[model samples]
Target: MRATTEEDATARAAVVARGCSSPIRTATGVWVRCGSRIKSKCESCAELYRNDWAAIARSGVFDGPVTEFRFYLLTLTAPSFGRVHRVPRDGGQRVGACSCGVEHSATDAGLRGVPIDGDMYDYAGQVAWNRDAGLLWDRTRRRMRDRWDSLEYFIVREWQDRGVLHVHAIIRVARFEAPTPGVLRDAALSATAVSQVDAGVLVEWGEQARCDAFRADGDGAKTIWYLSKALNYVLKDVATASVDAPIDVWRHQVALGDAARRMRCARDCQPQDCMNLVHKRYGSRSQVVSASRRTRNRTGWSFTGLTRTVQRRLRREWWESRMRDEAGDDAPALSPPPLEDLAARSRRELIARGWSAP
Candidate 1:
């Protein structure tokens, strides 16, 4: 990565990792530089990416540009009227791996399934909700701005396809130089105007997905924090019967005998332009793709996905349960499932309930 100017060089120098001279060595910290730039480079890690050429990124440099991030993660649960065995987010223990073999402590991860899933949830609605969750949340951002007037800045909206169903967003609220503070806090954000705006948007999405999206049926603007924070938009693979319900063993057996399906059929489902989608979502049209796909880099699938996935796991395992605890029997705060508005909802509900759309 070429340093465009001297300031870039100085900024890059700040986070550069250094090495200690110990025969029994730990890996070296990495930074991109030249002879006069910064001599700090880990030869061991340099071997990991000899062809690497991407600038390291840091935050808090921009003046008056405060960012609010919303990560959309799937909340798993049992499908309606179906046998319940969705992958437990933490398998119902204080400290253990998820059904997917992810391991962590309850003090660290929280009670299993308390955050993402619980027994007796409407799973079908969640899946249907996932299909176009972006549009749903986008509407909320607009409505929120209109109602509150304080949030009238910019929104970074996107989704994550890795997990069951989820979204991610970066809300940029412009700061006034006079008296504005940092990111808006919960208590400060819970004004009547804001709550009413949330209610309208929430009801609209719930009605579209054709299921009550919230744990509590009505009056839940205070709990829609989930939709507000989803900028990365990765859908976590859920273990809920409702959303990721068990496949029918009999149906699978019959399909195996009837035909030989190409494994590529599964490949057909995955998108070729995930990085491109990320690029589109972030409005970074000409983002440098100079590094090879195989290289272990920040933008690659493994590194970014791993950090995001672990975060989802940690969030499901930690934050959700705590919020539920704080909310008590009252339903905990969560992302409002993203969905189409009344126009789209009318078409689908017509079909689901055996009616017609005019």
Candidate 2:
């Protein structure tokens, strides 16, 4: 009997590792996974989020007509705010001496992204660039489509260690219309947009950009894998500071946060009165990951009709079915209560538990 109990406990533990350990009780009194994409918050749900997007990304590459489309992986970086340390990753070969006139070893990780001169760093400009990155991308896509009419893309925005955003995009274009990687890179790098909020501000990609073309049948799968792995970086909060962070690193983050707090998110934004989350997120307001949408004229980024909404619905149905199987005749109704009712109940529950409602 003890052995049976131990086995049962082990099985439950395994199940929890794959699903939510602390499930939320909804208005219908049905338990649901707390769908957080941050791995630090919920490993199980984060894995699910990663997998769903990975599958969607793969579908865009493998599900459609293979030979008819050309695939390219493009990386765009933000303009430099200031000179920074160029410490290599652990076990990585040292590139060269840094601007500080010292050859930093790979072990010098603390100084990796810290500005060489913090006072001289353009923190305000960096945050403003983050705020306008989405608009810049919108302009970039429009420019690309103007030249190559059959372009569709999936883009992921990643935070550089210095607390700025850079973009990685998987681009697909009709085979006949696709340009050489160099031409594409030049065109994309040259494209610029003026900020709608700040009339005089010109938003542009950094000089360092890459566009590499790969055959959809050959290196395409590998490219998709590379991009999918970057999803891990998407949900991380740039403002989160490490407990063991070096003094310089900590100071850098503090400066960036301070700049973000005081910066206007919009032309009419009042820094004190504004409750915009961008102020707290290093001035970044755009979604971390997104793909072009299906339209009347263009095929969307995904070849399959797979989307986050569809994935969520499927997960809900699967969870309900599993519950029914486990509970047999005692299972609750599978249908969820109205969203408004659930939200209201959740708010009340939070308030009763000494937490403020949104």
Candidate 3:
């Protein structure tokens, strides 16, 4: 019994050391790492996720002929629903008086996103905007492509302290017709979309948009780094509001949640009965990160064709090779057992352990 317990403890330690805190057995009877992107859930997996996307982002800027393309880092914000306190971050300079007639300090961070007047704040409009944000972006991108035919982009959607979604995009275009940063910013900001669900509503971006062109060999690396860092924000399950939040801040989040819960995510959605995650996510239904994909007529977002799938395949091959090398030529064949046999054996073991087998 002691020997068996010791062996089990050693196996668990090995798994932890390999950065797989949670391993799940697949239908094929192979155990694999749970690919969670949230750092709080699994730091190792989250780091891998961040690193994979970062590599893909870098490939888009560095792999192709640098001088042949123009790169721009663009930021777009959501339209404000109402006035909120503008408290600077820790160690940041103080802004002037807020609309409420108070110069907020960093210590007032708890009220940063809280509405100045809860009754007047457009909670319904904010939630509705969040629901339609993806559609708006689709229209915006199409409009931009109409002017610049060679546009390819990678975007990360970040949550503002005010519980709204904003965009940070790395955009690439052929140099023949690249526009000035100011022009690009103007064009993007001017683009708008009509909501398909709520036909009467018009979707638009806030006036706080920016676009900055950078050289692929110079500021481009720094721009990529900045966007890559935003990936960490994407891992959060929801808005930053917490249980111990200030009363006003808590009420603000509650209002957003209530708004989201009642908002129609789809044309056929029944708010009370819908099980969609949109209700729990502050009315946003879009993915946190995405990139252009390769098509017959396009080179895709990554110039070197480095994507998460490619990274995974490469990692798996390297891992297998290392395992074989460690086993040595004198050892038995390091190849895995046949899938069918493994599956049958796994089923029997599961049944013996009083667990259902798929």
Candidate 4:
């Protein structure tokens, strides 16, 4: 689909999927045929390609076994002196604390507690950097790894949704050569290493960046959604949105906080959290995993691209585009299905699963 327009993202997916199969050779022949004018893609070929993407977006794991390691949440704040809202809620009161050595909580009946100081870091710039954020984070990881005693592979990824970016990573501490937990999760390293790396890298990380450590735990469907691994996820996620918004409904902080704490706690609780322990840092290289049980499974790229932000944006863009097309074609406005439903599946599979409500 050229632009995921409303005219038919689902239908487009269905058509592409059903029409484009040709036993896609992972070999060079497939590329040559698909790209050449002499060759044409059948429905099965298209479906295979689209389904591959769907599978990756939905899989959420890397090509290899998941690594079980700890990660930290990061945030950088400007020096401002004022009462801050520790936990803001949606459809809830805006609570702020005073720096006068006293903490007070009152239900802001008028909802006037949250403040806009304008000193917050440049968020727009950070989001732009986040576009290539995966790379920036990679560089940061290298810097941090250098300080470690034992070398291991590390993978860092950025997940963005609704303008919020969360850093998910798989850090491998060398087998039988593990660093002490204090050293691995060292607060000093959290400060020094992060600062050193951040200094070399230029990212605004929206007003400020906060870093907290995460460890993975699971057995649940969204079990991969590590809360402890999200260390400090709630506040940072919410705060970043606040700085960029004209009006913030940061009322979900409580729920988010609970989730973040859980993710952090999970780091130590679950042993099978990551896809696999990383060894060597990535360097202009890529790996291929087959859909074999003993080897890499479906959790390739599919599960990742589906992170709430990317999925939401895909949906929103499609909806707006669809609306525009409707107006242009003089078609009456029809209530479109939620973009989320669309994001969760390729158009064909979605229709098959009966999640399609178009």
Candidate 5:
């Protein structure tokens, strides 16, 4: 959708008449296809997601020179509500596949994040866990902030060993005072006292919580890059697991049906219900992956175009020189690079290439 300052009410009828279709071509002769993060809907867009988020995670590590701070790889897992289809893992080796009678490949979206027995799967509970997992994570981070003022992090939610949800985060604390693993574990444990998801359903983290200190040298980048893996998952499977579906759709497809149910919210609760709860309480929208305010304000954080800043300037100059040749010798010299943040410069470059704000 086009980014606009306000609604063009007059065009609403015409726009609706056009309906949804494939990606549209821009003035730059580039085809802007459907930007679905789900791989099933659009593989190219998913790849774009992987590249963009990977850079974002990487930038969160080294971009702002978080050198004064120490980084940690923290994992907060969800407590098991019930047994579902799971890919067992031990020491990075497959312990065994799911009980489901099928050979599952690494890229098999259909086989992952599903219940071994749909009838027995706690679909409603699972949805509740997904809803509160982010809050639990925030509580843990707030506890961490008590130790340092300048804290920055990015978290990724993944469907884990069981059909449950867990969080993987890249936590950075300022002042270079790294806490021991035990202390970090204790902080996480205290945060696990998350609010109730239902009448009798209290949300909690699983027994296994890990906090590994990132190496001061270069491991910080590696840790962040590691967590970015979830940005590109089985598109179809994740869509099937969507948390935004209606009650009947979510229950039949995710809670009771054999299809992989990975969508947002709880099985007992409908998507709209869960969304309203989250918005009312937290004043925030639901999202799979998210970053803190400080993390988002990094210098180059928003420069996610195809080329880097210098490369874009060079390309612009090359184009200008060619245009000058056509105008005989009186063409003006190429202007110097703008003295602004990379993101701002990139936005100008996009506009120069014929991108207009709606």
Candidate 6:
């Protein structure tokens, strides 16, 4: 509100409808949402983003009608250059200790994507792999056509336990040829043979490449939920890391951040570049969940069409249900005001007469 004493008017006052200069207050007090995908940067927004992705995954945009189509989960990993800190699932049954001498805890975030020996770790190879990962997947998709007439796939890339990027994809085929796991794996490996990393060299998927079909008889929602869970894990794992960790521990983390900065062209990349796609979708200031063009494009599996509004509503419903489950149905619902209403308006727009006294 503003007031002034003018020669023509004895004390004119104006009530300006403008956003509060200060942050908005809620039941929890004044809160500012950073809207970051990284949980450490902003927990609320990251959770929201994660929920949005889960909603999209379960929405069947790529996976299709659960009852009508059978889905396959395929993981194509990058080849390893050397030993790295790997938190053994069986408590060091696989490998006694990472050559780094540190027995990484099962839950240690720092240990997952770091090289045990940084000096010997192939940073050049790692960068090359990241750059061409999309191409590799393109080949794999082309080859998979031989097995199924129609296919829908959603692929996400994440830095593996060894700091190399790997893809986790959900493939849906209508006919259900039901190829053995080895068949799909062999096809993916064969696709890698076509990759021309160097004139004389070929890039290959890591030995850990896996191709497994979802249980034929499982509930539709459950199967989709499981894929969504894999997606959520990838999103969370790619979130920003603590800088205090050792160089090897956080090396790939740094590379990922750098790649995101450099790779801005969506058309240049496939579904593998999650970080870059994310940055392009939402600018640096705002980070929301997003899927890749590869998933949405006609090249992959298609789903029964749903209206945009319906899709959004379904996502919202899923989020609400998740919230209810976690906090109970009686929990307080905090619905923020629409952004347009809350945002500040221009002075001319706020003024009733379309003009203000000089």
The estimated TM-scores of all candidates read 0.26, 0.85, 0.86, 0.33, 0.58, 0.58
Give the alpha carbon lDDT tens digit for every residue of 215-288 in model 1: 21222222233332231121111122243322442232223222211111122333232322221122112111
- For candidate 2, give the lDDT of residue 159: 89
- Give each model's whole-structure lDDT: 0.26, 0.79, 0.80, 0.33, 0.52, 0.52
Higher-scoring candidate on TM-score, 2 or 4: 2
- Model 4 has a clash total of 66
Better of 1 and 6 by lDDT: 6
The most accurate candidate by lDDT is: 3
Cα RMSD, model 5 = 10.5
TM-score of 1: 0.26
Can you give the lDDT of residue 145 in candidate 4?
A: 53
Worst 10 residues of 3 by lDDT: 335-344
Off by over 4 Å in 4: 1-13, 17-84, 88-115, 119-136, 147-166, 187-223, 227-358
Q: Give the TM-score of candidate 3.
A: 0.86
> Which lDDT tens digits does candidate 6 get at residues 75-117?
8787876666666664445545666776666566556666666
Clash count for each candidate, listed in order shown: 31, 0, 0, 66, 13, 3
Superior candidate under TM-score, 4 versus 6: 6
lDDT of 5 by residue, 152-269 (tens): 6677777553345667777766556667766876776776544443445455778888888776466865676577666454223533455554343344344422221223334364
User: What is the lDDT, from 0 to 100, of the residue 163 in candidate 3?
Assistant: 90
Error of 2 at 12 (Å): 15
Regions more than 4 Å wrong, model 5: 1-21, 24-33, 84-120, 192-201, 234-236, 239-253, 256-285, 295-358
Write down the TM-score for model 4.
0.33
Candidate 5 lowest-lDDT run of ten: 5-14
Please provide, for model 2 over 211-249, each residue's C-alpha lDDT reduced to its tens digit, 9 standing for 90 to 100: 898887889878878877788876655554567667889
- Alpha-carbon runs more than 4 Å astray in model 2: 1-18, 21-32, 239-242, 323-358
